[model samples]
Target chain A: MKKKKSSIADKIFVACNTLFMIAFVVITLYPVLNTLAISFNDGIDAVRGGIYLVPRKFTLENYQTVLGKQNMMTGAYITLLRTIIGTVFALVSNALLAFIVSRKRFLFKSQLSLFWVITMYVNGGMIPVFLLYRNLHLTGTFWVYVVPGAVSAFNMLVLRTYMQGLPDSLEESAQLDGAGYWTVFSKIISPLCKPVYATVALFVAVYQWNSWFDAMLYNRMKSEYTTLQYELMKLLSSVMQQSGSAANAAAAGATASAVTPVSVRAAATIATMLPIICLYPFLQRYFVAGLTIGGVKE
Target chain B: MARNTKTNAPAVKITWKEVKRQKFLLFWAAVFVIYGVIFYYLPLGGWIMAFQNYKPKDGFLHSKFVGFDKFIFLFQDDTFLKVLRNTLGMGILNLVSTFIMAIVFAILLNEVRSKIGKKAVQTISYLPHFLSWIIVTGILHDALSTSGIVNEVLMKLNIIDKEVNFFAHPGFFWPIVAFANCWKETGWNAIIYLAAITSIDPCLYEAASIDGAGRWAKIRYITLPGIKPTIMILLLMNVGNVLNAGFEVQYLLGNGLIKSVSDTIDIYVLTWGISQNDYSLGTAAGIFKSVVSIILIVIANYMAKRAGEERLF
Candidate 1:
């Protein structure tokens, strides 16, 4: 009798759990899908509201307006350039530093490790870093996106941990073959560390792709260097500030009446999100592995 | 690390010959160390501006020194206090909401019987975590606009008489920030707990079931206890980060109407240090925040040590 009651309770529990999970998935996904729908909807029609999962008056004018702008094109170009260049620069530098510290025979290994570890806990905060950037003449340059962030202490430590796990025999054999540290690092360790390198590469790439603050802070005056995310931010903020009864007034002053700020903002947002959405499947695999590995330590 | 160095330093001799043997490695190491010093250590030198009436023209050397007056002024200022309160308020709200939601989601996710269903839900859930805060905030604005779906639902349910402009209210700011943080981070944060849960001994669950424990009983007795160490460690780590409520969300989502509840330490620093050109005061405020962060982290580490949980250090 007790077993029968317990089984019935378990069935009800499973039903409720399934319903909860379904709700969770819906809540997580509905916003993105709704945004997609709004982006395709006619701007003036959308202002009437009630557009949910599908467009009320479907149109491609929003995307056309967003993509036709010179700044938007430039922003996309810069974002792509930064993501590619920044990821490579950060990965190589971090791997090199990790290789140096991972060497067991190196006298400065512990000191080097300690040096990098301290950086993770303490920083000079924002103003000091901003001042330092100004002093270095890095405030207005493209290198501001690439160079200052080239070697993160956390990524370096993650790479070092992976390298430390590699057997000493690999390096010894390479050394026996007249290969120096660079050759061993470039030819041997780097190839062997491909899995971790992929993880770190994806991490850096996503960060570079998504970064807008650096552009806003350092290169705000340089319109040419603005990133896609920053451009979307500008559009979104303007729309949000004037979103109520004044939205149409602002829209009439802009380009065509077909593309309101809301619709254009949605279109730009979807455009900005395109790369991430395309890469998310691969990102999910590596990041899950990366988090489990990096999260285990400080 | 300090202990290891003290014991090993006396045993190793610094000789020119030993250094020369690893000249190539030493050369690269020296280059990186210099790079680290310039980029990392050099910034700390600018902290001295906190004590001076800093001027860009006079540089760090010739600035008129004011001791702790800037810091004193900060504490006495009403705006600074409000900013502090806002930062703490938003930070604690985000921490609690994200922390609890992640754990609860992980537990519920683990209970799903279908492997494919579990994987799909998790993959979809993590979609928001990868997007930039700008995109998240943009979506948030659209959803909470007076004519948006939230108001639509509330009206359909007859919860309110008419559409409510959610962001215009001062009281809703913290909760909105907390909800945004949960929406973006809960899924990503749950990954760790999910990993923890999977590692738990299946034997324990089997034993509990044989003892006539229901699903909730087993979860309470076995699963929750299994992941408690992770929960504690993550909580302590988050406690150390209670000041970092985040800047982009507040700065992007905020308007004049919500300024009192929205201004954070980062915004305060940006306004004074960068916009207002009061570098000394900004540096002083920045210094205060950093000092408090380090103190909180130390306290958290001490508590972890006392509690015999894993210490971050």
Candidate 2:
């Protein structure tokens, strides 16, 4: 129905809301576009200012520096391996756990699930966990990424809830055919639950890709084990220190002869975000379903 | 999920055959159970260090017992108290501002006429939520640099003669953090409220319009009350994390100059406890955080239930 009163205040509110949303769109896009522009801009020209939305002078030197930086190949290799391997490991382990606890024939069902649910509510904080890993000799090793996070309790509950919603007749029929638990899970439950698996896999991949705190905590002393995020963290922190003092850059006049701090940081930001920008949009539809199912603790 | 269903239906005899049949699944369960106990439960035992003069050489058993001393010391210390204040301040700032903005955005978005325009704005807004904080804070650092775009714009508008180094000033830290958090999360958080608003009965609005009530009046009387449950549920859930103000942004953005305000409990643990090799003190601090959080969430959920609001537990 159309507005009956059509009062000036209602019209003004609509206009104001429209403007606010438009402003929001600009604020969201500006940083990404500005970062993109700076990444392509020549270091020297970028520092001279007025490089708003487009490159003043185009160059690829920043990426080259990033790719060629010390031990970057190791970081990239570790990051790639961790993302793929870690996501798969987590999904498989958590899915198996979920299936066990979800089975109608399975005894101790509530107790089995409750064992994991408690861990979700309480954690032993960082240092204890760190010390535990240290005692296990998991520190300064690549397995730290894989072994510790193999089965997430939250993802287990989500997958279990999703699986439990499926027809029991499907499993009963499979059992009548003499199909084993693993067989039914592999052939039927696994394929039928692709949506939830995909959702959890996406979450795990993103977490692995975004994790630098673990790297910093466990592998900071081990130069060979630096992940891509930790590498970027180091790069960003160093450049931020340098760029914090603007006068030093102007006095040094080092932008032309060397890559400027802003451009390098921009390049680093772009490098870190490229994969996310490429992957997240394709998987965006799964986000709401994932969040709701994951949050369905009750 | 239905444990009694099969047991009550079949009345199958408990025998070695049934045990053999389920052995494989239970064997599978054993693997994760062990992993959980090792990774999740083992460390919980380490919290005992909070009550000890823990030494790496002596280990857990031999560490001299200093029962409740560390906690008393923690409370007596001014630095711990200050970080607690900082954490609570940032936490409350984030809670109120983010909730208000999300609700506002949801209401306003529901008012949009053009479907395309509304979808485009929402899609753009979701970009920041998925991005890494390192990237976001990097963007902020560049934009807030002395010669950055923000300073350039402010100077052009003659807001100040000189540039403002936002990170250098402790006074602006909380606002910057709160606003940035709102910018990142508002769109994502609004999705639930939008879902709530969409489910609102159209008949109410139609009746309000038939009675000559305007858009604002309909929204005030119907749409808000319609979405009150969603708001209550989210607010209750968030109360569980009231102490978890934020770690990533403050840790990344914090420098020595702004340490007074930027040093959250997480940072305090890292700098004063872990960095100084005072593991016992750090464990004490961590235990204190854990205990207080558990208490807060329990009380919050209890109050929510008492008020007939949405309770997380």
Candidate 3:
């Protein structure tokens, strides 16, 4: 009797687990896939009926329109440049700071660490940051993106913690082999810290990629150099606002003729998000391990 | 003890000498110090603009001093007050909903013993985190539009007599924003908790099973308690950022019609700082927000310490 009941319970457990897992998969994948379907669907069809899981009438016209727009392509180029330059500067600065802070024997390490931590808790906020950019003459320039957010405190802490976990014996052996501290750090420590470096690199890259707020705040000469996300936001907001105004006009007994190109907007969204989404699967292994390591307390 | 101290003297001396010899360490340290001084500390000095009627042309030092006027103006402004309320309301909603969903998702995900199934689920969920908020807002635009999928589905099901204007209505705006936040972030946020869940000893589950405990009982008695520390730590750390209610989504989703309910402190700052060119008022608001956040963090840390849990400090 006990054996039969236990088997039945086990079967129920497995079935429940499978059901939950499938639900999670569906909830996560559906919205993204839905967006993709809308992006591919013909604009008119996409608007008339909701494109859910699949495209009703498949088309790449939306992509062509978004890409063919000279402004968006220019924005993409600017964003790419910013990401590359910002990541490099951030990574170098962060790695150097982490190395210094990781050395327990270094004087004022604790004080410096506290300083960095305090920055994480408190900031001068956006306006002051804007003023600072203005003072430095960084606004409306490429340096606006790269210089202001060159180092992140959280990334520094993560790198420092990762470095701390490495055995001191490695540095000691390098010292015994007549290598200087710089040489050891460059030739030995950095190579060993690849996984953490890769992790930090990915974090910085994503930050640069998704960042539009900085551009929105500082870069007023939008025609000169807007980031990809910012351009998309502008486009989306404009369409929504136009539609809103049209509705108001109609409510006021005026002819509301302005139509929001919903398909074009969806296409722009899909286009803007395409590179990162495609890059995600490749970075999945590192991303999961990095997140797990970073979140797991020592 | 005397012999041990005498023997450690040479090691200590060597360590001191090594530190002195490594001038390169000092070089790199100085480089970082310079970076921080220029970028981090200098911007902080710009906070003085909060006390001044800051003009871009007048500059920080030359700006006319009007101490506390901007802050006073902020407190008196109805729009500012509404923004504050909206920020806190949306933040609290996001906090509660995301917290519940993350924990539930983590628990459910933990039950999956199939490797491939778990991996696939994880990959799909984590994808949204990589998406920019702009794109997410775009998705929401389409999904919640009058002729959008959500309304279509609802109408087909006879749930509503007419299309609901999900975005324009102030009452619905906050919830829609919160729901979008939860949808975008829950899976990614659950990851930390899921990692915590895995670290729980399997032997505890075995013991529960031996005691004839069912799955729910095992979860309550064993799993919940095990991940409680992780949850508490994350919650405390996040309390400092409650005012951040997110900028991009709220900004993108907000319209003039729903602005009263949707404008957050960040949006308020952006408006004053960028749109009006009243940098002083914006700086004042920003400073106020930052100060409150710091206070909350310190208090949270102190409370967590008293409770004998892991604190950010």
Model 1: residues with Cα > 4 Å off, grouped in runs: A1-6, A246-256, A296-298, B1-17
Weakest ten-residue segment in model 3 chain A by summed lDDT = A251-260
lDDT of 2 by residue, A1-298 (tens): 6664678988898899889888888888898999999898887667787888999899998778777787666778898899999999999999999899888777667678889978877888878998999989999999999889988877888898888888989889998999989888999999999999998998888888888888899998998888888887777787777765656656545534556766776887788788888777678677767666565211
Candidate 3, residues B52-153, lDDT tens digits: the string is 987778776788999899999999999999888988888889888888988988888877766787777877877778888888887778678786777788
What's the true lDDT of residue A20 in model 3? 75
* Tens-place lDDT digits, model 1, residues B1-313: 1112222323345588868767777898898888888888888888999999999999989999999999999999999999999998899889899999999999999988788999999998888888999999999988888887888889999999888998889999899999999899888899989989999999888778778888899889999999998898888777868887658889998889999999999999999998998988888888888888889889988998999987777
RMSD of 2: 2.8
Cα error, candidate 3, residue A192 (Å): 1.1
Clashes of 2: 0
The iRMS of the candidates, in order, is 3.8, 3.5, 6.2
DockQ per model, Cα:
0.55, 0.53, 0.46
lDDT of each: 0.86, 0.82, 0.78
Alpha carbon lDDT at A245, candidate 2? 67
| Best of the candidates, DockQ | 1
Worst 10 residues of 1 chain A by lDDT: A246-255
TM-score between candidate 1 chain A and the true chain A: 0.93
Docking class of 2: medium
Top-down TM-score ranking: 1, 2, 3
TM-score of chain A of 2: 0.93
